[model samples]
Target: MFKVVICDDERIIREGLKQIIPWGDYHFNTIYTAKDGVEALSLIQQHQPELVITDIRMPRKNGVDLLNDIAHLDCNVIILSSYDDFEYMKAGIQHHVLDYLLKPVDHAQLKLF
Candidate 1:
């Protein structure tokens, strides 16, 4: 079993994802949620989850910065953002992110990952 972390500034989004996703089905033993990149980074450093789903724009720290900080960690990333900016996409690519997902996420698309 693996662990996964979900990072977003919105409470509804964080909680909604936690409830909607079938973590057990995906072989995830634990799921952690963070309201911002600051908390997410701390969780990542401590727990070292196998997967991280993060938002691009966040308070305290942004996703791109978090990506840079966690580059040395052995974890896959899937960027989640409300913005469709190419710069953000480029950053994700540079960071070797597994995928870049948009806001109001599609459950089917997310499940495929």
Candidate 2:
């Protein structure tokens, strides 16, 4: 079974994202969430989920920092951010992030994953 972890600072976005995906349909048995990068890193280490979707900016650690730590892992990475800055994309690129989603993420867009 595949596992997934989503990291974001906003409670609503976290909850909404959790609800948006039909994990069972995607063959995902476990879904986890973290409010900030600190907690996110801990979850990633503990669960080692196959997929990680993380926000670009958060209190503590930040996505770039987490990306640095997890870059060697086999899991797929997706970045979420409000910014369209090239530097953010560059950092994600350095870490092999597979996709980027703007805030207020569209469920359809995510479904494609």
The candidate that wins on lDDT is: 1
Error of 1 at 89 (Å): 0.4
Q: List model 1 lDDT by residue over 1-113, tens digit each.
A: 99999999999888888888888888988999999999999999999999999999999999999999999999999998999999999999999999898988865668425
Error of 2 at 55 (Å): 0.3
Backbone clash total, candidate 2: 0
Instruction: Compute the lDDT for candidate 1.
Output: 0.91
Kindly list the per-residue Cα lDDT of model 2 for residues 17-83, writing each as its tens digit. 8897877888888889999999988998999998998998999889899999887788999998888
On TM-score, the leading prediction is 1
Per-residue lDDT of 110 in model 1: 83
